[model samples]
Target: MPDRPATASLDNPRYYLQNFRSVLRWVAGHHADLLTPQEAVRLAQFEALPEGSQALLVRMVMRKGDQFRASKLSYTEIGPTTVALQPLVSQGWVDPQPTLSLAQLFALLTRAELVRSLQAPLAQAGLKRNATKQAMLQSLAEASPQPAPLAHWCPGIADTVVALRSGPLFQRLQLMFFGNLHQDWSEFVLAELGHQRYEKLSLLPQSRAFQHRSEVDSYLQMQACRDRLDAGEAPAAVWPDISRSQAPSPWLESRRARLLFSLGRMAERAGDSTLARQAYRLSTHREARLRRLRLEEQQGEAEQVFCLVSDALKAPANAAEQLGLVRIRQRLGRRLGKTLERLPRPAAIPEIELVLPRQDSVEMAVVAHLSRADAPVRYVENRLLNGLFALLCWPALYAPLPGAFFHPFHAAPADLDRDDFIARRQTLFDDCLATLGRDDYRECIYQRWEQKQGIACPFIHWPTLTRELLDLALGCIPAQDLQACFERLLADLRAHRSGLPDLIQFWPASSRYRLVEVKGPGDRLQDHQRRWLEFCLSRGIDVALCHVRWQASPTAECET
Candidate 1:
């Protein structure tokens, strides 16, 4: 590691401010060309904000919390007044009074450590955790008004509660970091499970959500118990009873199977063979069955284990499970057929590049060599980001194009599917194209980007980019290609923006580009990567998946 500068210290508040400056300089130095006139103005105004506001801005940019309490902002370095944000407020850069409710707070707390620390009952005969949480919060609220301090449970509870009640979330993240708060359907849906748990109802048409908050609480408690059992820490006196619980849908069943699998692992780690097998036998999850098979093999209970694995094979199997099944079959010496031909290679095939684990460095090296050779060939990884940049600007050019809704920083619609998106693409593309055709579209893009004019927006990762690269993306890349990629990305923004190749080889003179996804040895295509590859193939996008093999001495591991 490099030596730290003598002047740098976490104790100094100014160090944070200096970090803010460093971040701003990086953004300015990289995306300056992509910035529209209005964006430049907005960014300049942000830089000139009061020192405290600047500090607060950096705080929001760096953390997961959306809203912040005025009290939390009442520090010396950051101005005491949330009202200092009036400039930002007027420009829609900040929502000073975002709405939040008690129900929301309870939902958030159920998953939080405070509830876990309370040693709260999961299945209290007829009661749910939601009821318990609300009752507790009600007590706190009642206590709050009596001029007595409420029992503060955690370090950040007061700040969190205050934020939930009336704090502001810096909603206009695209202006600051070119993205919005974390907004993915999976995350939102999973978090929302707490709400369904509170309501004690199943979100079956929904997934991840459960009928009881106790369901989650019990899972959490069991996980804790498992960890404690493994680490030799003391556990709570009581535990949640899974059998006495209400009838479970498949999702809950799968979740419980996972928990049982975890318990089996903990028991195995603790050297409790009987307890481990009991947990394993109780679980429907395939991995648990595999472990049971192993244990039964060790105990010379071959018949019991074989019957168990054979029954387990009835359930749906993913790639990993299938591999496990194959391994178990091999262990039994029954795989004397074509199944052996389909097995994954145990080592790298010596036919590719010279990277061992990952090709990130090799890809960069290859691209760097081409760049140095000056063959008009440059590596552009974010050839896709340009498409995102264009999509983000659409709402500005076509006011009705859903700028009131969609933006780059924001995730695309959760309910929206690929077919629906493609069906509506014509009208959207027309409006965006119309917007881009005008000489003033530049101003529109800038204003929208500056003011954060949409609910759904694009997010840019600023660190791995440069101004020259962005310029090349916008100028040298073909507009048609950008449009094609943008349409594909919109088909399912959650799924499609990923899986792009590690590097792109671009010919500036011919405006031609080829994608190269470098793989080292045992690397295989992930689901998302496969999705991207399929899209590229269908669209005639020249893409190659290159596998690399590493040559190393037998003592390489010892050397390391």
Candidate 2:
């Protein structure tokens, strides 16, 4: 088998990956009625595995549930090394592979997570428990790779599941599309509850109590509604119809908010202004309010929005929110001479020391030339292999918010010690970093780049990433810096990851780098982006937020 950069799946790697991704997408689109977003994701990941890995996966999968003992996966067919499976494990195609250790479990604990993990009796007894992680680290190594039962291994390929029959609604959907239900209960529950607390949602045979009650989730019930709407079903037929016997208690709080929000969206799309307005008023979410305001302007109900803004102006607001109020007043009543509050003068920060690019893709064009003029530079927007690298190096760092896997992303626990975080992270990184970076640290990232770009990709795989882009990113972005940057991103992805500077330029020959965030005219820094800029700039990472001002629109004849 070829070493790290290439998988043993196929000989013509590029052609195979492209064709496979295309075919997967085609199947997903054609069977849109038959799959959930998560199920479609599983199909792509499962098909991307190497033939040997696929065979080995069948062995492990046949024997256990979603996350079985990783120790059971050291098979002869896959490879001589268990590390070969890390790509699958890292990408979340295989539950990010857990290791058995006390410290690892500790690293995953939040106080909320801790309280939730143990009962009141046990919590009280163990709340004061302590350990020397550094001392514990010296003696421990990764749990050894154990052989899966060779007897359990099936000889030939299993029957290709083409159609799904015996199952629930979600199951039937997955079977028709991806051939299996890849979503586990944890993920399903997480989706249902969102950032709220975790509670299992199950269906029971309808009873007198359940006549007006809903044991099933509102979101789950919405599936068929969305499916019908997408299939060109009329809005009246597609919207859920609650029977007279059904309980009014089912839609409460957030459930009510979600239903009203969904109703407003559907009503607006169906051109029912009256119904949309009613639904929008009942929704508690800001998104619903914004959509309603936009709709009001569209339907000549601007007076309502104007009244809303006028009444709400007594409270504090941001510049963006204030500007929105200004627009509402300006456009109200269609009187050209009618005046409202003047627009606030937006702050402009001049970049006097630097010469900004005039090119449309200033970031890309500037960096592409700078790479040639000086050294290598690469654009890593969503292709954050370094972030994945950090995760791959330390799966325990996933430290999901106590039962948070089934809901929206949340911040890591605040009470974790800085030394402890570094210690736990370094301990995990140390386990494989040496072997991965033995010959060249650049190859370490490059190998992960291959995995992320290859079959182990978790999501809808990106358009084929180029070798030149890979080479420069691997060759330039320092591996040493990857851990620090990724740790910060993970520490608070909501704040840190998005709004990052667009380009990272590197002078590999001199071991130097700079981060550049390019902004078009009239674009100011977002709050989250400004946080990243401040963090990077304070750390002396040479980050620049470049706001581009175009001199003039280039004539088509002068276009490059």
TM-score of each: 0.36, 0.40
- Model 1 scores a C-alpha lDDT of 0.48
How accurate locally, in lDDT, is each candidate? 0.48, 0.46
Regions of candidate 1 where Cα sits further than 4 Å from its true position: 1-262, 268-315, 330-351, 354-363, 370-501, 507-560
Per-structure clash totals for the candidates: 11, 3
Best-performing candidate as measured by TM-score: 2
Q: Which ten residues in a row have the lowest lDDT in candidate 1?
A: 196-205
Question: Model 2, which residues run further than 4 Å from truth?
Answer: 1-165, 169-217, 240-263, 284-286, 298-304, 310-344, 349-365, 372-375, 382-397, 400-402, 406-499, 507-514, 517-560
CA error at residue 78 for candidate 2, angstroms: 25
